[model samples]
Target chain A: MESPSKTYQPTSTPFDVDAIRRDFPILERKVLGKPLVYLDNAATTQKPSAVIQSITDYYTQINSNVHRGVHHLSEEATNAYEGAREKVRQFLNAGSVEEIIFTKGTTGGINLVASAWGRKHLKAGDEVLVSGMEHHSNIVPWQMICSEKGAHLKVIPINQQGELDMDQYTSLLNERTRLVALVHISNALGSINPVRRMIEMAHRKDIPVLIDGAQAAPHLAIDVRDLDCDFYAFSGHKMYGPTGIGGLFVKKAWLEKMDPYQGGGEMIKSVTFEKTVYHDLPHRFEAGTPNIAGAIGLGAAIDYLRAIGYDSILAYESDLQAYASEKIGSIPGVRLIGTAHDKAGVVSFVVEQVHPLDLGTMLNAAGIAIRTGHHCAQPVMDFYRIPGTARASLGIYNTRAEIDHLAETTRETIKLLS
Target chain B: MNSTKVAENSIQAAQDSIIEDFELLEDWTEKYKYIIELGQVSPGLPEALKTPDIKIKGCQSNVWLHTELKDGKIVFSGDSDAMITKGLINLLINVLSDREPREILEGDLYFIDRIGMKQHLSPTRANGLASMIKQMKIYALAYKTKLENAN
Candidate 1:
């Protein structure tokens, strides 16, 4: 009575993905004498020429120090760097530019929150609630801080579908819960949690929440105002930009109360032997000279994405997800790992008797690159009782044709392996 | 008494033979196929001998190794969960298993790069290969110390 394409909901926007693919030069290359089908976007997306040019533009022209420098080059460089912060503010829909802090990556952003905000707010007996499906970046930072403060670190369990157990999460919240940090979308399993509901629940108990948006930023549209979350964090490289750059979106209220993440130049207004006063908002958190070119590149990436429009990206990716879930999911010997009803840009799976590493290697030989192993979320793998899953995560540029190739390749590999 | 042992020529001849055999293979796929075939001939570790203490640490695939000293030769047996890794382990065992501790410690093992294996292996497997060789050398050094003490 049902059809396979029943779940495939076509989006409103008309997408020209072939034109988009042409923008990324690496997509035109070959992997193993065959066309490269890059399904590793969740690991790191391929940068477009626009983003690459922005980086080159920085080096070729307007290359200088930011903030403290008075020279012409410094002003130009500082303008570009600060302009990137404004882009991030607009990108996340955060309240102000002052609320956006530059970081090394998502790990650095999470660590900054744990160190600066956690030190002032948390104490012994307080609990930091995190979901079971967090990447090590989210888990370890909270773990480090919780352990340091003699506070307990509580976990929100996940069901077999890899969705967070809301009943358990709600039950665990109490007067002792100081804060909650959850992933926007799980990198390992493509489950998108009901973060708005969870954030509201936490706010009821006066507990601030931090959403790790590393995986979600590239796939979904995020609005800090709509989510009403206290903090949001994401990396630039995962969004088709340069590496060594990411941003943390903290609410102005939280910024006012929290101490500086690091003590160094620029973070301080004036330094004396016995007296030191810190700067305001974002700069208070970012201590050293920031990644000037990387931030500018990230800004360019945002501009490119904005031009394509999120609606088009969403529609295209959903089409890819539905197609992948059906085609790749239906293959013989392939057991789809995460089958959450509300899923996003990834299809994680395993073939019978074939280790993920072997499967990935065989696929690589076929010139299809899919990520293998724990995906830096070992707890998620442990929960699933798996060594790892071979993941094919989608980006805006991925096509349904590529999905068919993936399914065909996987089916052939399974037969060969079996 | 030593249960089973190969001839003196067999241990050293294995490396030369493998290099010659790999030269016949045309591409990475063929080399990999040959490697998987080689895993079939590997002297798998006994259930009792597959102890956690002797497992290779850095390999992405789990590999258990056991070693012994017979007539001053460093006898070895190993197994891996993955066929390709198992084959690679078997190839190592064939070449260096029964060679003298000092010979293994000083052996070049140039055949890794000579047969284009260095280029073919993935980054993790390359690290695993280096770790395997390092672990083998560590075992030889221990035996070398024991042999010296016995003197």
Candidate 2:
């Protein structure tokens, strides 16, 4: 008898997905008396044993506050923390380590930029341009800053296929446009935006751009210098790293001019009754004692990804995405929401007369985890006039058989509900 | 006994019957299938009554609940876009609807727990089962106060 969870072998590829699955311990676990089929990678990826071990090693061996103490343990802790920043710098191909600022997550990174940069530059009637497919994290921060500064928040619309209207995006760029913030990939729709071209368009107008790479960093190889995006924000957890640790990449020029994000211990050079001078580039924004263990864990995650290489990851995922799109789209009453030409390994669909919540609950009973909701992209949902979508986002560890199981169960669920 | 006392006893009896029915089901699929059947058979709230004012917030699916004081009992009519949520709503309506406001206000819904559907009652469950129960109790409290004012 053939195993239901048999690994799908790709012809003549060095990408051994079965071997990769062993790195993630959670994949071996069971949910609801069935093998767990995790399809919620867009929400957060499962951590590898290497990443977990790095975090454990930090707490067990090198546990101390960074930068302040003259003690040996402090130096070791600071080295590990700063080492993680260097790893992130390499991961994004950022010019310097000074360009990386540790943040709480993608939300925190965007909020920092909105507070620090927008507060200084934005004036009344100025506009911040964002796409309709942006996550709430990318949209809300700009809205908050815009409302405060009396600036306008303009949206570049997306078509029914979930691709951004590049013509409208170009027109939206004008003298009033202070900054353009865009998502590299839409989390809800799975559409990978042409960010490189968009960044060039913004640059042509001499307007700075911020790319929310929260979804992109996990799947794509980021080259900050090549893209030339002024600001790039990504969460570590999305890329199989620890929660509460992420990186924000700002150009050196902007970092030098922007105001400090927060005022506290690590951010300051010296503090007195009078005025206090802030620290250099990245440290000025760090403020408090950061997530030291999380940073170390993220470093390990970066190392693990580099070992597998992005070329193999992208190729394998493209195949998986194609398989999922074909198999899932063929189901009756299941309409694929985002039919963009370019997409990540994510399938967002809605079944006729079957709400996403119902489908999600039924799938959970079968031990298949998926994300169901507006995916924090309410504007995208509003554009499509859907309540939500049942999203199955793939990770590097996912198999073709798992996708087959998903499609089969989804068909059964729809039948049972109908 | 008074009518309110009889209504409370009926609510308990209805919950026991639901628990007994659920216990006979083999697994989650069977249990939810039964719920789905109940949802299919249950009458929907009139489209005119599904206004934003009556819609319950925080539910992943759109759910609208309408309540009225008919005679001495509070009647609830609710509907949800999701079948499972609608089924849960129908179950609640069965146990608590068409009962005296006093009975509804005091009735503890233990059937959801006894039937292995305790997850629905969790505050974080996007179905908003807990919120629906709370909203129903709020309606009962308001109707009870109205009765007192009228007397």
Query: Which interface RMSD values do the candidates have, in the order shown?
Result: 1.9, 1.1
Deviation in Å, model 1, residue B19 alpha carbon: 2.8
lDDT (C-alpha) at residue B81 in model 1: 78
- Candidate 1 CAPRI level: acceptable
For all predicted structures, in order, the TM-scores are: 0.91, 0.92
Please give the lDDT score at residue A27 for candidate 2.
97
Clash numbers, per candidate: 0, 0
Instruction: Please give, for residues A1-418, the per-residue lDDT of candidate 2 as tens digits.
Output: 2221112222223589988898899999988677999999999999988888787777778789999899988988898889889889999999999999999889999999999999999999999999999999999999999999999999999999999998999899999999999999989988999999999999999999999999999899999999999999999999999999999999999998799968998999988989899988799999999999888888888888877888989999999999999999999999999999999968999999898878888888778999988999988888999878999999999999999999998999889888
Instruction: Report the C-alpha lDDT of model 1 over A159-204, residue by residue, as the tens digit.
Output: 9999999999989999999999999999999999999999999999
Which runs in model 2 stand beyond 4 Å of their true positions?
A: A1-14, B1-9, B49-54, B66-75, B120-122, B142-151
Worst 10 residues of 2 chain A by lDDT: A3-12
Write the residue-wise lDDT of candidate 1 on B40-97 in tens digits.
6776887787789989999999988889999998998888877778888888888888
The DockQ-based CAPRI class assigned to model 2 is medium
Say which candidate scores most in DockQ. Answer: 2
Give candidate 1 regions above 4 Å deviation: A1-14, B1-13, B41-43, B68-75, B98-103, B138-151
